[model samples]
Target: MASPVKLYVYDLSNGIARQMSLQLTGRQIDGIWHTSVVVFGKEIFYGQGISITNPGRSHHGRPLQIIDMGETALDEQTFTEYLHEIRQHYTADKYHLLDFNCNSFTNDCVGFLTGGSIPAWIKDLPTDFLSTPFGAALRPTIDAMYRRPTPGQIPAPSPRDPQSASSLLQSVANRAAGSSSTNGYLPTPAATPLQATASVASPLQLCTNPHTLNSLFRTHRAVTVFFTSQTCPPCKMVEPVFERLAEDKASEGVAFAKVDMGVGLGGEVARAWNVRVTPTFLFFLDGNKVHELKGVDAPELRTQVDLLIYQAFPPHPHTSLNLSSIRSISLDPILFPQVPAFQTAQSKLDGFIDASSSMDAKQKAKCKQTLASPVIPFLQSRFATKINPNIPQSRVHAVCSEWNKVTATLVDALPTAELFPIVDMWRLAILDEAVANWCATGSASGSSPIHMLLDKAVSAIASSDTTAVPRNFLLTTLRMLANGFSHVTLARTLIDGRSAATPNKTASTRQNLTSVLVATLLHTDAPVRTAAASVAFNVAAHCQKPLIDAQRNGRRGVSVKIDDAEGDWEVEMVSAVVEAIGRETQSEDVVHRLTASLAFILHLSPYYEVQLKPLLDVLQARVILLAKWKGGNGGLGEQGLSKKDVRRLVEEVARNLCP
Candidate 1:
């Protein structure tokens, strides 16, 4: 159930700033604004860092005002997950008093929860204060008070530091009654124990204490430590090299840490590890000390680190191949961006609407009105212009509403065979982000007009035995689904049943978009098969992005994010693309696209070894792709790739499978 989200507004000055602000700053400021988002029985705020407390029970006491910020559709678990991701950006060290304080945090939360911001007064208070001469004069002093050390160049906040910002902020707001700091993170609600949030761990961690170092050892499979002292000149020389190597290995389930033997609890750690020397390196594999070295040797360091990575993640067999061509190939998705002429598409659609005896008089009138002013004009003006014409949001909303109404009515009135013209028009319109996001939201809830229409087309194909579904209908539907990937939200929806409207955990790819794309991969028509290949490529690209990003950032292993939400669809998609490629012999375009999609699905993918490799071997992907590459020997009937580039690509894919 959706719960009400409220903004708990507090006057940090306890009304003193309101009365004294005119004299102090020469401006009539109402109050020193501090805000917390109150939602799901938790009062969430960011000061030293993101903190959750029982509503209205934090040190701030009663709120000056509680503003209703409408209901949040995000369930507690999802919201908690969002908090986990967002907290990285709101760490205690990143906090600023005049900028990015409690109010900034609340603004982001309100925007996510309700698609609106915290009131202008609360959000604009910092700007209002900074505008006055007195405030401008105080900016430097305030900034200096909140300045943080350069990131990754210092030790973690020492537990012994009693004057932490969280305590200081609390004391200042509470009139200096007392001070307290207890790690800044309190227990979250029991109902949603999101202890494990999806966030990239910092490449370099400063180990000020044994506790932090132990935590790293517990969580990571491999941990690399650089032990140094302030007095060690060699430590300074090798610091940059260690940091760089840490960044390169960070994403490979390796945690890199640095400890200063002379500072805080670092002395205890050094003594415990029996490291009497400065600039020592210790490598731990699975919490056990595996190797130790004492030196500033860069080459040896690099060698040992590479050896550690190899032990952690064995290289894929495909990595041993000598295919320079495949490595050079771009993994970017092949998107269908050609927008068919809007007028002709609309004209074709209008004929269907006019001829539909099933469409009511009121429905026909609504469709015509929608097309004349908003829908057709919006598309023509938006796409025709070289420069983006700054169309107002009101007009965008009008187009979205009208498009939804007309499309929903048409889907109901027109038969599946006659739906191609309208579906084609939709394929073009969804290239716009706003319309695509709307359609994605509707798809998640099973209410979108485009979603409903695509379902009808898929149903027609399923019910038919032989080429009964119209070719145009299949082509248009596949193209529309391909265009759905133009926006990230819609792409995720099409790939894994995730949408902006709701988080449907039970959402699967066995049916819906995946089923349609898999079935149409071997469609009788070449154009339909090509279009299906495009859709399959988009899906592969979505799954491939994180893995590629990890590898590019110098991480090891293909990433399986949050345990692979699509379940068995990764195997299903690869199997379908391999089957489709084997049968496609007519169009070079089809083979090239199908080959690209297959390569993307297989490249740097975790599914390859455990699932896809066996499947590829069983299906004899090597033979099929090689047949395309080699062609019939000496004027045989076999049609081989005529394009050198396509043949090279096919050879590369085949070599990886059977090399």
Candidate 2:
């Protein structure tokens, strides 16, 4: 066995990843990363490089998989097969490992991959179900695997769909933390008393990256993924709640992940799930299919998960105490494409659009009718138009009213931020061809018709008015621009040094635009702040900067904030902003608004995650910052130390950034 190596990962959700490169050789790298954190721990993480840097991708990737290859006659063969044939070349590897106590897990997988044709008696039960061969075969193996006890030191039965991974992980973390700090070896996971709100649904897998997604599937069980982008306003709305839930249950065997779909991670994944909107949530169970819940801030969705879990693990099972072991199979074959089908919402927009001039007059007429379905009016009746699509822009400007009306009329199934089709429309509307004709007369007096249409969308979102317009609509536009490189061919002649003109925003430009939009979104009023909170799940989409600067400057950066000094005020605005950025960023980006924004997010993150990795980085940085507030980098510690006390030291850092 390779000597067990413990690699501790700090939080680097922000721009800090820009320069990070995490590489591993056969025997030297063993690690753990805490994404939803801002605090520090004692574990040390080393890489061949200076740091881990990943420029955010256009689309988010899959979750971190935890595959356990239980004991078997050919355990090493099976394990090696999985690595060599099943999971190869998949990058962005936060984790990958082989588990020796996976007897139950392996047999279950064999059953699934072999199409569930295992013996009838062992057909449907979990491997842990006693009185069954599969279960009995692995009992000894389960005994050897490390496990934690509850207060009374009781070992958990076995791994299954965890109700609260956050809480579960917290227990392990606390114990591990305690032992590691003093002696460096955690005891074991406990059979923790199930303690949590009844409605906290277990998270499922949802990564947009194909390689990562594929790799994750090969490793983990019961996972949930939050796939979002800067263009997805609804993703933002649903983020905080998801993060809180994930944080609350991290140790419970459940993993909550946020993937940037814009990076081309999941290719055809969005389409497979019929993901017409942003902030889509997909759940998985040991590679076998689970469920998908769309939209953000959804009360109905939570109910669905609650029902599903009950079905999977009934409170009272009268059927059989010795549940049979069903083959562990994979549902991914049906869920994703090999390289990821990079279908844009535009692809789903066939026939309804007038992109062709070759259609017969009748076909054109039908297309127009299809585009302007009366259904639009029917749908809009339920959701009154806050911004009329008719103010005159492009065909889509007129068409958006129809789409918006229908979507609004129906139940909001996903976060407003992640509605890709809507984002595409917004993107199209802003094109010069779409908006050129409608502008009363500014940049497009003589411009094409599309330019005029875009103006309306731009004008509406840019307005100080934060009413019925979903935040996703605006964020989508920004995301389109931030990751706009994919459509670089769409660029018009460069007119200025700061901004480039383009027919449409593509995945490449998202990075550049993410920061600006984040700032713009933050600058709104109180109601807007509340609106942000309602859909704050967007943070799961991955668009935050630092909360404070590192320059020992007077203050932190000016991150775009959701204005919430009133109402749920801090809940969405102040707190959401802080959580969004965390404490990771470039040295420069770390200052001013970016830094301030990060500080705010950590302060607002659920208390459980307050001391998470991202926050910890800042805490560590502040330790140095305070040591030299007046002394410059701790050389003359006491002098600057007296200038500001410890608690005040941290606050001083925050005040400077926020101010």
- Best by lDDT, which number? 1
- Model 1 scores a TM of 0.64
lDDT of 2 by residue, 289-332 (tens): 57777777567545544443443333221122221111011111
TM-score of each model, paired residue for residue: 0.64, 0.22
Encode model 1's per-residue lDDT on 370-485: one tens digit a residue: 88777877877777667777876557756787788777777778888788877877788888766775665555555666566666765786798426788898888889888877
lDDT of each: 0.69, 0.32
Off by over 4 Å in 2: 1-364, 385-596, 600-653, 656-659
Looking at model 1, report the run of 10 residues with the lowest lDDT sum: 192-201
Best candidate according to TM-score: 1
Worst 10 residues of 2 by lDDT: 20-29
